[model samples]
Target: MHELSIVMSIIDIAETHARNASSSAIEEVELDIGELSGVEMASFDFAWQQATKQTLLEGARRQVNRIPGKAVCLDCSASFPIRQLYDPCPVCGNHLLDIVSGKELRVRSLIVV
Candidate 1:
């Protein structure tokens, strides 16, 4: 799964930060993953379990914040919640949308010690 690669990248980032901070281990990690970010949560969890072995983040507590999708109708300038990609604007039934949120995939914070 692509989540494995994502997890690997996260580990790289965490390691870089921990090394820069002169920390021996990462205690916690917080992530923000939005619904529209194309990540499968179940697959991500499995990948995380497999990827963290023998690393600084091996024992780190992880927290994920799920961000709900939101978009604005380009035609009507109306904003509404979206459940999936390419969802039409609820107010105008238009496909022309400007995504306002819910495409996030990032490491929000890390606690190293």
Candidate 2:
């Protein structure tokens, strides 16, 4: 699955950073995953468990912050929370929207020791 590749990338990044800092282990990892990022949480969890073995992040605590989807209606200038990518504006019911947030997938912080 693609989640396994994602997890492997994360492990590679964390391990690279830890090695650069002269740390033997990573204590914690903070990630910002948006609701619209298309990552299945259950699959990601399983991938993480499998990918982190024998790595610096094997014992690291993972903290994932789920960012809610938000968008602004272009026609009505109304802002609203969305659960999906193609959701229409709540106020104007318009299809044209400008995404304000909730498309992020990044490593926010890492605690190495």
Give lDDT per model, in order: 0.93, 0.90
lDDT of 1 by residue, 51-87 (tens): 9999998979999999999999989999999998779
Instruction: Please report the candidate that would top lDDT against the real structure.
Output: 1
Highest TM-score model number: 1
Estimate the overall C-alpha local distance difference test score of candidate 2: 0.90
* Position 72, candidate 2: lDDT: 91
lDDT of 1 at 68: 96
Q: Tell me the spans in candidate 2 whose CA falls farther than 4 Å from its real position.
A: none
TM-scores of all candidate predictions against the true structure: 0.97, 0.96
Counted clashes in each candidate structure: 0, 0
